[model samples]
Target: MTTTIIPNLQNFYNQSQQKQDNHFCDCTLQWRRGQLLVKPSGQVKQPYLPSLHNQPLLVECLKHSPVNLVSIDPKLGESSLRFWADACEQAHKPIFLRIPPGNKLPKQSSQSLRWLQRLIDWMIALVLLLIISPVMLILVMLIQSDSPESLFSCEWHVGQRGKLFRAIKFCTTKKYKLTPLGSWMCKYGVDNLPQLFNVLRGEMGLLGSRCWTLEDAVQLSLKEQRQLNNLPGITASWEVETQPKLLHLDSSTL
Candidate 1:
């Protein structure tokens, strides 16, 4: 009996082999045939009364097997079975598939409120910064006591239309030789208050793509740079949302 396995299936098997013994059974087996063929010596038992869905067959097979996770790739062109498999896979259930059609592009919303909402958020942030400047001064003085260096760190950030400006914040790292208080403010994002000045000055907006450093901005692909065409740069998104995750994934891939 000859069976053909997808290259991804082989990779999954190799990855599974490196797992701990107690976790060794989490294998996703993918087959490209109409029906699954089990080895008589294989200890994993098939689930009784399995669904006919082919998309998630691998997942279902894994459930029935001693393993906690499994995936199957079956013969393509069977739409009904493929739909069931896709649904099962989405639910994190076991299923099989033969690589269905590519996903459709998502539609953009037509509501005109997005711009107005961004403007309102910017105004609120600006007002809050003005009301808090006095307190910020006091904090700056306190930071200066901890480190007798610069109380604020000025970082060059890229904003909308590829404009560059200095973004002021409290320093967080002792290695930077800035005021210790600046470092404290940076650690908690308290130093980001001054960026409200940038917002009011039209160099930034409240809810938009994050501003990048010149070095980082150059790394953006042409397609990614297009996202900047309509919006001002932001202070927080890259640090808070995107960079850490991307770095982790890149390291893992390497």
Candidate 2:
């Protein structure tokens, strides 16, 4: 496994909506894989995913991964700013005042808060999955009929707290080759629907940060790493914010 850091793009909910329930909505980090992909969005070499011989190996792999904490941007709100300052003072690691603070709870709140979040995510994922299943089936049949070799595929994405997970999505294209099936998948974003399962499994949220790829996350800075503290999401601030800018990042600077 390679050493990688999380990106810190923290910010908080608006000042008026301070309830713990609502704060997570904006604490989300920004992610944009299609935009930053070294190649057009398609099957990346399977080499990108970690190989594990056993369950313990998997746990050890994650344990070894450098942690990237989720943080709220100081520029976003006051509470976020205070929390970021506090963490900086306590950790005393870096001095990037040129400052932070999430879903990683303005620090880890009570069980009740956890329960509420789980329930909401579960309900929404269930509903969306149900509504999309038929269309999904049709799409799958079309994809398989069009190119039987590319019916299914898994994308390795960096999830909550920077753990790597395989997100299921349509194959879209044959290995190293683009087909008509791949074209539409990218055009309509239908390829992302399966992420709802990621949501139901508690690995992601519907409205959280843009899902991060391990390739992209590895390029993040200590300051940017704070972004991982929040739960990874399917739709995020990226939709509203400008495109993410990690394509040209130089890891040595960090």
Candidate 3:
């Protein structure tokens, strides 16, 4: 079976691999014909699943072999994004469709939850800094003695949404001047300590999406826009989930 990738769903039928579904049909007729196409807007189109089957059969197929995400543009107004979201839930699929009120965004669970999380992060980072202060101080001295550079440095990173922030870190050398201490700091993640201030200042969430760069975000695929759908965390989901999935998919596809 082959899947067609057309920016315009209305043209799916006309560019058929074979004439079996060459006739144009509206979404209503296509759904009635037990064919499912992951499209947001289309007046006339071919249903990807337009086999001689009923709704129940189509539902079963969807449940078994479903596409995980389909982002629909809310501006299209061809179909209710909510309706498709519900249908996807019933079929155990997930649609990243845009909802109404374009300005609406994903929010923290609650004000209390946000404050509590922040308090917890503050306490944890503070306590850790207190305990490790002596060691960090010694490391700073050693780093200064070993290298002719500052013990700390700041790098710019894209925070939540597209805001830029200076992420301070304890470092063994200045920019572009690597030292032996830098290697050890990298191995142990000790250089990441100053970002505790970022977590405290609410520039980033403790657990959210991955930190990105302004250039990196600009270069992302339209399909990858969902990565920015949520607030970026100091440690992010992309570092875990998307990275591994892409690796496996690339190897298998090759």
Candidate 4:
């Protein structure tokens, strides 16, 4: 694979939360024969030759690789970004789309701190689940009686560092018609209760930026995309206080 040195966009998170000094985060990206390859910084480079076979090959060569994060060169085109974005999302790795020089890299916490935060998230979700078990059980029965559809609805949403995950919520509506019980549940935001499972799964937190669907995520401006650096929250200021007018309104609501 053709390898070249590029200025790494290291440890970027949302500005309001994290900060990191200038330091090389050991990561590598390779482009050869129209395919992308990611490797560790310390690995010895191997000679790459274009394959002679005519059969198609999967572009994701590192699907099982242990790379923690992947960074894309700012100069790469949209196709490359989309390919890596989907790949990284599947591998559950954060992706960094390098910004141009002179722009401040967003602040980020250390890896340990992030892990600590995740542990806390798990604890909080567990406690909440226990405390609300009775209410959730009653809601489940009501939802079953209200609609023939499944009890939960899940849709693809962008998570921290642009990773994509299915955000789960209670199925409050069927065919766009909110059930009588669903209307009451939504009015009190109880429809969001199922998302605590997403928190336990590490796909969301108790408080952070709103979770955006992939369609809306792709339409985001470069500056707005930075919000993906933070985990989507079960309850966030953006949902009620200061919403993004650009998002598809119907999709934002349960």
Best by lDDT: 4
TM-score rank order: 4, 2, 3, 1
- Compared with the true structure, model 4 gives a TM-score of 0.57
- Worst lDDT window (10 residues) for model 4? 49-58
Full-model lDDT, candidate 1: 0.48
Which candidate should be chosen as best, given TM-score against the real structure?
4
Q: Give the Å shift of residue 100 in candidate 4.
A: 9.2
CA lDDT, every model vs. true structure: 0.48, 0.50, 0.52, 0.61
What lDDT score goes with residue 36 in model 2?
Answer: 11
Which parts of model 2 are misplaced by more than 4 Å?
A: 1-111, 237-254
lDDT digits (tens) for residues 1-254 of candidate 4: 46532225353333223222323222345654543444333444333211101112212434544455665543344444555566556555666544323235445666677688889989989999999999999888888888868899886666776665767778877776666676666656777788898899898998788887655666666777777777888887236522333122335454
Q: Where does candidate 1 have its weakest 10-residue lDDT segment?
A: 38-47
Clashes of each: 21, 16, 1, 4
RMSD value for candidate 4: 12.0
Better of 1 and 2 by TM-score: 2
Off by over 4 Å in 4: 1-109, 241-254
- For 136-179, candidate 2 gives per-residue lDDT tens digits of 99998998888888676775555666544567777766655556
